[model samples]
Target: MTYLGFYILMFLGYINQLFFVPKVAREKHRDGYVPLYDSFERFYLRYVYRRVRDCWNRPITSVPGAEVYVKERVTHDYGWSFEYTGREVKSLNLSSYNYLGFAESNGRCAQNAVRVIKEYGCASCTSRNELGNSDLQVKLEKLTARFLGVDDAIVFGMGFATNALNLPCLVSAGCLVISDEKNHASLILGLRLSGATIRVFKHNNTKHLEKVLREAIVSGQPKTRKPWKKVLIVVEGVYSMEGSIVHLPEIIAIKKKYKAYLYLDEAHSIGAIGPRGRGVVDYYDCDPNDVDVLMGTFTKSFGSAGGYIAGKKELIDYLRVAGHAGCYASSMSPPIIEQIITSMTIIMGEDGTDDGMRRITQLAKNTKYFRKRLHQIGVIIYGNDDSPVIPLLVYMFSKIGAVVRTLAERKIAVVGVGFPATPLMEGRIRFCLSAAHTKEQLDYVSLVLIYNYEKDSFFFSLFMSFNKTFPVPSMAALNSLFCYRVIIFFILD
Candidate 1:
């Protein structure tokens, strides 16, 4: 009976109209969580599925390969399609990190990944510090530097690992690290690992950065004190959540004025911003050499998997020797490396190819069109106009979740941002746009954002009130009988 009620609500949830907030309100705590985590146990636990449906409502019948699919795919034995009751959906992929649409077709680089796989098989034989370093790996560092407009560069196994290992090596107990409040989690982890005095300034506040730098200078140079060792100011070239960009020219000036080393992580901005998509520095016309440290990921714009740090030769040289992730982790696979290397040729404007630049402009155009439409309908969009990452600020987390599910029913794929990923009160629905996304698909998403917001408010309010009245305990109470199953699941489902 419990399973029966659960399936019924789930059916309603996944169907059209509004069902998410009321269902999630019953399942997740007021804080937005539920237990029953282990994979084996989850089999019996038919969840209040919060996964956003990005593919248009067509059933995905078959997946051709990575990032490529046959339309209306049903059997997602792999890739984006999933076989649910025997229907196929060629999921229109918007949640993916492939920014340049390079992965959508079979290209030279895509074939290269396969060719390398045939040559090297799978997996790196050892860590970069040991037998794993290949000749191609060495060439990538130099190629990345030339492409990024920097003096030198070093590739990492992944973006998170780059920060995780580099932060500790660069900062120590005596140093002070000033970071933007909205910097990525990997950077936050790096700061935490550095054991330095960490002070968070307002996001993109140059004045506050100066104030902190002044305080650090004063504190470090006291009577009978030691000379200031170093200060590092970290900010993302582009923020992920709101799809906003930092004021780079000002940040660069401030960092120089304070004589502090600047760390710019261009995770989102790399393939999306600037004239040729070189990122914030390019947007501002600042010399890439002026930046003391620069890091970015290939997951998004590059349409590959990995990360890198490019800067002065000495710094890159030191990081290569001292960086923990560089030393300990397996070197990136030959295939993935080839993908990035091939991507760099196109991204660097070599061979007179402006395809990447053209794509960035197209993405910006689509984003503006969608965001403007939402604004016209009185839907608030968070972040800058040019960014494809648009956030719809909805205070209720469950509603954000429900709206994602609601939009999915409409064949629009979107994701929710709330709880630990974002502040609890700032819960929102995040629409991560890719270059391959069509105008029609985005138009549907823009409309659905407004449609679901109005449709779910009533359900959201009811569930919010219900949860406040009677909070849930562990699953231990769930299997037991309830006088009113409707009332219980609506409150504790």
Candidate 2:
């Protein structure tokens, strides 16, 4: 059924393009210039993606707390462009990665951030190796190392750049990288730029990883049959898209067996998982030193910007000069650095209160309760029971847009995913649970999903009953049908 829906949309897209010239094709300025986008990319963006584009990149006017005010907008020509509706929809925020609920304006974290901004200005305005490095950066690096239980750590201005820029310094020609199949784009880009031979293993499948490692060991360099310089196994602590937790202990064992170094990216896991909010290593009760490189971002759990790489002091010293980011990218803003430091201090319970542990406990409770509720509601959700990143499968492309749009209308904000971010048949809505969300708020969201699911199932059956001989409906037809269903939803309310 999922494939049928997706193919019908694609078929209609092809037919539409065959008969009429697209707006992109009619542009006069590119007489001799090469096309900026791939042919199919342009086609997908126009006919397939445009219908559902409004579901993403929603502008929010308030702090992305448990609740947020989303700026409302409307499109006159499909999703080609949009204009503000001069209204803001106050919605329950399940979109932002504010796991610990520290993304507030009046809290200690925010206050510290503001104070630092006043004292140190906004940005460092230079690279770490240049004049940009500050006392906050040094202090944060030390605190990050202590938090992760590592010898030393280096901080970077951007999370994505932390991986993209550092990986090249760690591995280059003659080295091999074994990465998870569902690894983030940043990891993929880093591995690619590193000029290393890359091998992909099944997502969270430790056995496949071990097999790949064994094969690589036996095969050695592609044609020369010579031993590789070094092998690095890179996996995320929590996969952002699939919501799956990595089998860190098993992978650590595999890395040891194969004499491979481990690079664990805890971008989504740090301060979001484990009893201490210390990430996967803590969750599994594994020694931090088992993993060679510990990378994490402050964006998700800490409610700040920047990323850090924690490892041995030798590694940190090498990266300070070898990594592109330390050499070229501007140092992290002082305010952002202060935000992380303050957040980390709270999480470490260094502020003479149990606030950090309370948040961690609350997040775990929320994750388990939400997952259990989602299962009871009969929706297929991905990931482990403890993972806070919950991906509820919607399956159909049209339904992805429908669920997101309808939920937003119900004052519940959610993020929808579809190809090429996910497999076409596995489109889903990812709901990021946070500690700040009360049980009442969660109950409301659950009720909305349950009601929406019941309506969606009924309409889906009706649509599926159409005769096979009838022509497949276009994207617009499917969207209109869903819109009508949304209207009925509100009317029945």
Candidate 3:
């Protein structure tokens, strides 16, 4: 039945291409016009290209020393995409994913990175298998394994490429790959390109995952009773958009019961969770050996480029040779590797100072306080209470941009997420809280939100402009609503 549906869809698509689209000549001399190419160009210019011409590509500074500058972007009379208005404004940054506040130039990591650059220049200039591997790269790989409590590890030049290019090498045809529905785009692309039999379970639903696993195992491959060459389960430690943690323990139990290999992605969770910043495995107190492949990136908490795949010695050794990314992609630079090692050292408290501990402790506290304050103000938020990443719900799609722009106007930078990044009506503003964010910053954001919501300000007016007839809730009403939700969302649970 599934095969039949797939064929039907393919046939329909072919029909649409044949009948719905206009036919045209490739050579100008044949029909005096290249109709198809011209039509495509016109469609792109009229519909697709024109839309992006006015949005995106605006410049914003992300450096730490001074407040970040966002140059004013204006549409010129010629309809150019972007033109700077000679105006710059310093804005508070709340959009980046530097979770542990390590993306700074003044830290121990920066110092180490400088020394590394002096020794190794700017680039490795080649793939690891060729002339790219350096002593620093080897040291970084070892440090990664030690940090993740794995036997060995392999490094990749780019984080997204690490997953996209390696998954096919790890699992191929005749294998089965079970993935979370909300997994990152890179994972999705990897799974698609792997040529493996793929199935998606509901996000974070271990029960659903188990059911699918049971069915796949019982049925085996079609027309043959051969068991799958392998069954690999892929999931992320944290759902980046929703700020939800994976039910790792439950998933691990199911994987063990089914005798499947588990591949965990710790891109957002590593160095931001657990007592020693060891990642989800440590946070759950699970044996790292149970996880067949542990993947993570230094871009987040470690404040550097590149990624790693850490697991047993044999697996890392195999990947070193077989992972296409490591074989062809340019190796991570020595400076970047040293930066990560230095950051990991700080995270592990090997620097003999309590600064790392203090940052972690404060991050936890700030996350809790910020969530609680938003709850108190009757803001509908999504995610686990302790997660530093928070999503404030904006049920109306129109309000997403309005709210973000309003905050930006107030010198606060925020990211607005809407379809197709999320489902219709599930628009939100994702706030990434960092340890660098002071109490004053948090309080200011909270106050701004409350004030705007109360005054029916321009931002709030955008909601009304969208034909929303309902009255905006008053402060007292919001407080009462918050109290009610607290009871339902927390107290009952």
Q: Model 1, 228-337: lDDT tens per residue?
A: 67789989987888678888888888887878899999888887777777888888788998888899988777777789999998998898888897668888889888
Per-residue lDDT over 1-493 for candidate 3, one digit per residue giving the tens place of the 0 to 100 score: 4345334544654565566653433445556644555654554343333333332344775553214677777776423345678898788777777777888868677888889789889897888788888888888888888888889998887899989998998898899999998899999889889999999999888889999999999999757868999999999987789988888899889998999999999998898887777778877888999899999888888778888899999988888888888677988888888888888888888889888877777777778988887876678899888788899997553466568768878998777775556764576889888877888888888878876665634434443355333233444655544455456558558
> In order, how many clashes per candidate?
25, 0, 0
Per-candidate local distance difference test: 0.69, 0.89, 0.78
- Among these predictions, the greatest TM-score belongs to 2
Off by over 4 Å in 2: 25-35, 456-493
Better of 2 and 3 by lDDT: 2
Q: After superposing candidate 3, which stretches have Cα over 4 Å from the reference?
A: 1-58, 64-67, 76-80, 456-476, 479-493
1-493 per-residue lDDT for model 2 (tens digits): 9889878999998998789766654545887998778878888899888999999999999999999999999999889899998999999999989999989888899898889989999987888788998888889989999998989999998999999999999999999999999999999999999999999999999888888989998999998989999999999999998999999888988888888999999999999999899998999999999999999999988988989999999999999878899778998999989889988999999999999999999999999988887876667889988999999998997998999999998999999998899986889999999999998899888877766755666775565466233233333445555776788889999
- Per-candidate TM vs. native? 0.75, 0.91, 0.83
Looking at model 3, the pairs that clash are: none
Error of 2 at 51 (Å): 0.6
lDDT of 2: 0.89
